[model samples]
Target: MANTPLIQTQGLTRNYPGVVALDHVDMDVKAGEVHVLFGENGAGKSTLISLLAGANTPSEGSILVEGKPVSFNSVSDAQAAGIFTVFQEFSLIPTMTVAENMFLGREPGIGPFTNHAEMRRKARALIDQLGFDVPVTAPVAQLSRAQQQMVEIAKAFHGTPKVLILDEPTASLTDREVDHLFKTILKLREQGVAIIYISHRIHEFERIADRVTVLRDGAYVGTTAMDDTDEATLVEMMAGRAIKDIYPEIPHNPAEVLLEIDRLTSRGVRGATLAARRGEVLGMAGLVGSGKSRIFRAVMGLQPTRGGTVTWKGSDITNAPTRDVIGAGIYYLSPDRKSEGLDLAKSSWQNLNIDLMMGREARGAMIRPRALRTTAAGILETVELRESYRPKAVAQLSGGNQQKVLFAKSFGHDADLYIFDEPTVGVDMGTRAALYRLISDIAAAGKAVIVISSDLPEVLNLSHRVLVMAEGRVTAELTGDDRTEDNVLRNFFNETGETV
Candidate 1:
């Protein structure tokens, strides 16, 4: 077969007022290959993908599809050209069935009649091809993160796309699910479909990608075959510097109990109870929909509790509103940072000051803009984001930097009990280490911290004690010193004799 590029970009440049997102970058993906885009948080990989996906138009440069230069005015235009994109934030509708979402825009119709049965049949075939066993008629919201990701992949395949783009698709998947996705990608590669895989997981590129492309500071570094590279070299290429071990050893010496939950029950959590002490970081590890997040959400008063008693500093705070909870010095940050934790379209100053203005601190209906800027600037400085950026859009920041912004918001509040849900998803090693250090500092400052994460290594390394949840129940409480990935996995599953 002749080597004709399926999609190629020559000098793709996208510029904002002060930020040149992608600067004269070149990228190419040939038929029957998996091309990985590797970069740090703010390295413009997402911007390049957005341009290719038609989410944004390039300020300069050109894109050629099958040797024909084209301008993709919208996503529909890209779809018409056989290019499909699956983003980290799923586009599946919760109320719709899997089959419905899979063939959303181009539903099969027989003589002006919508064929639901045929839709399910085709959806089932596509899902089976991907090695996933989800029911076609099931609502997407009820499915696990892995299942949702599988559906997203199925949707892309349903488009019969010649060029497929996946942005951080494995960020929320389990190890087993990741293996399944790898198998599906290999199958796609065999079928002559060009795949563009974007991720920060350096190890994944070695396993599945044929060629790796590195981008840094909005420019392309080089594209190298995976066999010719090592992870350390790739890390250096992405960050422009040598990165040593990022996770610091967590200190010991836990103090007295800080917050205690006698019995916590909610719609999502079924009669759960846990505790965290001062100067200690507690980790809640569980599978998707295992009720780990519910416990934290219930404590934060975001969700309604059926029956429970939450004792903070020896006072009952069951079902208390968030205002009182924040007033009592307890705060929670959601895993979905863009939607729940940040107002992305707003300026950084606005997002950082929203929580402060809500509290009794900023009393009037109208906020003091100068004072808000001062406070937000202080938070940004403390989190090490102000030096590099201030007054920029929070959404425009990279995943790691956005996470840092969320952390800064929490720190600015100076909450007594800090609950973070999946704090480091889609973040690079260097930034993850920085976040871990900051979390440790929060605990070291005599505040209780709860980290809810599926990444076992993070939970094991950052916490003073680890709590495992399964089937909406607290299965075991293990000391963090003795915790490992294998140990946590063993405890999470049944048929393993463990203590709680």
Candidate 2:
């Protein structure tokens, strides 16, 4: 039985109270192969992984592991069966150290005492193997988002798993880290491991996926070899439609300067000067930790400015609190959606109007719950959020839906100047197009928009003018003929001494 499939699912289905998450799906993975699951948000990819990893039970299906039918009632059972998973949402305990989190329930022990030294040694070895530099003794909460993601990956690989399910594993990783992960995946594949990879990034499929299976609206679509199917076919299969243009055309009319920064300096930013005008989309491009985010944080008053002058409508607003800036018709959308953008535990209606209810204007006014709900409903409609999901907690919704709520919340402010930081991270292609259209609409309405993104094509297509950052400094400004990916990369590499 050398050719026997490592894992197989027949008629797999999952159901929530009011939703059919997965419906009569059939899939299989061969030993020593990467089987990618491609689908949009809310298309049942998460449900499939959750069932396979024993985080959730399938309502109806049969799972066969190595030609034998097996049942997993808990994560421990799945682990015992040599199955492990790294989900999109992290599962690490924030209070625990990296080593402790990695070997949480399976810590090395001698008789009745835990072997702390051995645990630390194993954790350090794994981290080094993954090309990560996180300290083993450091708390998970103290690490950066990327570092935390690396820890999650390391934890999944702590034991030699026969089947590894990775859902959006590269969502927070940089290019170098992703390369390291690919190398590790290849090594694991050589050991006859079965990999179930799930991601929305189409470019990654060709590089890492051996076979791809498509799903739509909780139903199985089809499966194809990676070399046989192209990106266009994959997108059509995932979205069930032709998405011609994801980014809208930029408006040519940019009026008088709305917000201007002169020699701004902050904790993570060096001397930076920039200007955003009305009816224009100003794109910011840089690598991670290159200080692009610090500039926006300084403008929004989230970070203290050491020495800078921020002039908005000819008035100095430097060092002003975030609430005051937002009250003045300036809004900032944070990159970290789960932590800073939206409250996951709160309902969509609550998060949609929280800012307005807490604003200075509402301090002395009489509260009206009915009117607030009405207004929140209207905002949700404007962002195209489904009516049924308005009452559900934000955490229950998909990543794309949560992002829509963030946009709806920001749209409720009717701000004149909007700063969006990585607005579409971890979202599907269809949701990305909708967000880009919304951003364009905001700029077309005589509002100033600044979009900071790591995606070079996104910046190049959506910006009327582009600003390149390197090592906390603005390296080059591109407009007209210079607004291209090659030019931006050249500027981005100037300080790093790396070639494009």
Candidate 3:
């Protein structure tokens, strides 16, 4: 390996009001090496990427490209300098075709019209190069989340960037899709392109990264060769302290059954049966599109069940209206916070207070703004959101912060049965801990909590009893001593009759 750097940053700093996003951080990326920056959410990873992508200018710092210091005025400047970034959010246009999104503003054009044939050919070639099997002519909106992510990658590659920065690239990808991405990344490295990979799953880094860089609280911690560091060490460095156990054990007395779903069937899905006792934390785990989310939507009245019975506290509530479901102290928090869980245009206070503003909670049909503000503040504090962010738009806060606001909204109302679909999807360790504590507290308060996630570790750690679902049916149930990761994976593949 050579000592020459492809990209370098010195004394980088950025501040946002009360928060110091980045503080005098220095980083180096070498040609042909996959360098991973390890940090939790809000650990300056996104801010640093924004700076690299030229989406934001640094308040203080110097960035050097190809061993020469250069100031980037905009994203175009960064692209011209051989830098491309894939952020956590998908950037593809929903209404456009995959080929169209791939080229976008750089589509091939003749003297007066777009050369659609040429554009599609290039798009198909790029997809082939990346080993992605999606059709280039398909509408982007019709593709799954993982396929949309592939289009984002294809877009970055179309720019022919020498240095690629992927932020949480596999957050929404399935296991097979992740393997495909790894293959593409390795090909990029072979071509002498410097790749900066950032992710929460530290274990996956060892598969591709040459060296690992750790950052904590906007400051540089240390960098170590992948061979020299274990997952525990990397986690400790990223967190700035020892977290002996990722999940804190919270004890609760099991009571009578609080929720029962008998033969909960939707079209093309089977009898999805599940139950949760009062004060119980039930975990549902499965692969993507395994009918996990559909079951959740059915319970929340967001989808119509073909045939089933849902009983809450011994009362038949299947196929009930959403408002009636909420009235019965059963509410749901979705995985996609930006879309379903929040109103992006509304203020944080309004998002927090809207539920209360409905019906008589508004004090005889007139919403009490003062009371709403008070209540919002209290809930914001409950989820540990900054007080200053209360008046800002829900879109202004970071992903993890937005999620906190969602949690605050859920807790604002006294819901007995809480269905959290991918509750900690994009959250980091610190925020995730806070979330687990909040869930435990809610359940300890005698409410039933059902957590559905694709992450095995989360299900094993947080669930009192783990139920593995596959093909829209319950495959295996584990409790007490049988909920280990290895055990869960074994059950997942064994019962599903498939290989990982």
Q: Return the top candidate by lDDT.
A: 2
Candidates' C-alpha lDDT? 0.83, 0.88, 0.83
lDDT of 3 by residue, 1-500 (tens): 55889999999999889879999899999989999988887788988989999999998999999889988889889999999999887788889999999888898999788999999999999898877778999999999777888888888988887899998888877777788889989988999899999887766887899999888888899989998888778878877556655677867677999888887897534787878888889998888767777887887788888898999889999889887887777879989888688998887788878776652352345666787677778778889988877788988887788889889888666777888999988777777878888888888888888899987878888899988777777778889998888777766653453221
Q: For residues 1-500, what per-residue lDDT tens digits would candidate 2 score against the true structure?
A: 13788999999999889889999999999999999999888889999988899898999988889989889998888989999999888899999999999999899999899999999999999999998879999999999898999999999989889999998999889888999999999899888899999988887888889999999999999999999999888888888776556667767679999899988889878888999999999999998878899998998999999997999999999999988888877889988899898999998888877865764253445557787777777778878889888889999999999999999888767788999999988888788888898998899899999999998877888898999998888888999899988999888866752211
Model 3, residue pairs in steric clash: none
Q: Cα miss at 247, model 2 (Å)?
A: 2.9
TM-scores of the candidates in the order shown: 0.81, 0.93, 0.92
Clashing pairs in 2: none
* lDDT of predicted model 3: 0.83
As for TM-score, the candidate ahead, 1 or 2, is 2
Counted clashes in each candidate structure: 1, 0, 0
Which is the winner by lDDT between candidate 2 and candidate 3? 2
Pitting candidate 2 against candidate 3, the one with the higher TM-score is 2
Regions more than 4 Å wrong, model 1 = 1-6, 9-12, 15-18, 54-77, 88-152, 171-180, 202-207, 224-233, 241-245, 249-253, 263-273, 304-309, 359-373, 386-398, 473-481, 495-498
Ranking, lDDT, top scorer first: 2, 3, 1
Give model 1's TM-score versus the native structure: 0.81
